[model samples]
Target: MARQRFGLEGPSHTGHDVGHWDGLKAGELRIQRCGACAEWIWVAQPLCPSCHAFDPGWEAVEPDGVVYAWTRTWRAFHPSAEVPYTTVLVELPQAGNKRVLGLYTGADDPVIGSRVRGEFESAPDENSWPLIRWSAV
Candidate 1:
């Protein structure tokens, strides 16, 4: 398989919670949840930040959400990343208002509380990691 290429070289993904990326590669949105307290966790953690439980596991979640916050970047932090891209904090109502951050691909300006849905973009290489982009719904 060709190495996955998402255009931009992402930051280091090495860590315990990196399994979330595997879910993306499989076209699923997975998030960590506290097995004990059942609280949703973001940015993936080995232990639940809320209940202090260990061995948190992943669960598939609905892709639909509302934009809680957003911002557009004019500067290219990396040469491969295009400027003027919008990043959004999406609140997943199904997941106890837990929020996930991703790039917004819609043409219109992002509005707080706007409905959005996740769209997984596959890497140029079949084996490369996939990404989740959001679109206005």
Candidate 2:
């Protein structure tokens, strides 16, 4: 998640998170998996917390997931964000139930354990990156 993608400026780049970022740029949702134990890792990690292995590999995952949790807030969390937004923690079954966070844009109210699908929207220009928006399945 580059800060520039959200109209901010700072060191949003991460050596470990690059794979996830690159996947977003390619319009795919990527998750890191521990090569040794095959356990899914989120937020990126140089070493697998599961097996104490080095350099988990990244792979594209089925983007659909179930809503594990959610929150609605009036405050804009990021630059150029509209007031009053919902953020969801989605758990991908195929990705070992590893949850990923994204903005919820579904018309219906967010409910716990509701099924949702990830939608990728390309950035307006090269200066920005794509975002993974969530909606009810």
Candidate 3:
């Protein structure tokens, strides 16, 4: 195996949540759920904080979700990502308030309480990871 190249220059999943992108590629929303309490977890943790259970598993989720929160980022953290990107906190119905953070596809069409869906974009290079971009509906 070789060291993976991350960041804007590499694949979209290169920065963080590489596993999440991998799941998306397989047509799943890939959320971490606690096997003990059956509660959903975000930001991907080794164990469920709610039940403190070491048993955690990934489950498929609906790509469609409500926009819990959003913001327009003027700063370009990644060179590949255009500036003024929309970042959103999506609340999945299946997760019961569990939120996933991702970049909005159409930054100009942002709505606070609108419905949105996820679309995973392929990386420019294999070294880069796929990105889950969102669009408001």
> For residues 7-88, could you state the per-residue lDDT of candidate 1 as single tens digits?
6433245565565777787788888888899888877777898989987888888799999999987786776566677889
Task: Pull out the clashing pairs in model 2.
Answer: none
What shift in Å separates residue 48 of candidate 2 from its native position after superposition? 1.1
Overall lDDT per candidate, in order of appearance: 0.78, 0.80, 0.70
Number of backbone collisions per candidate = 1, 0, 5
Error of 3 at 31 (Å): 0.6
Against the true structure, what is each candidate's TM-score?
Answer: 0.84, 0.85, 0.76
TM-score of 2: 0.85
Minimum summed lDDT over a 10-residue window in model 1 is located at 1-10
After superposition on all CA atoms, what RMSD does each candidate show versus the true structure? 4.2, 3.8, 6.1
Candidate 3, poorest ten consecutive residues by summed lDDT: 1-10
Q: Summarize candidate 2's per-residue lDDT along 30-108 as a digit string, tens digits.
A: 8999888988998688899989999999889978999999987677677677756777999999998989888888545
Candidate ranking under TM-score, highest first, comes to 2, 1, 3
Best candidate, TM-score = 2
Q: After TM-score superposition, what is the CA distance of residue 73 in candidate 1 from its true location, in Å?
A: 0.9
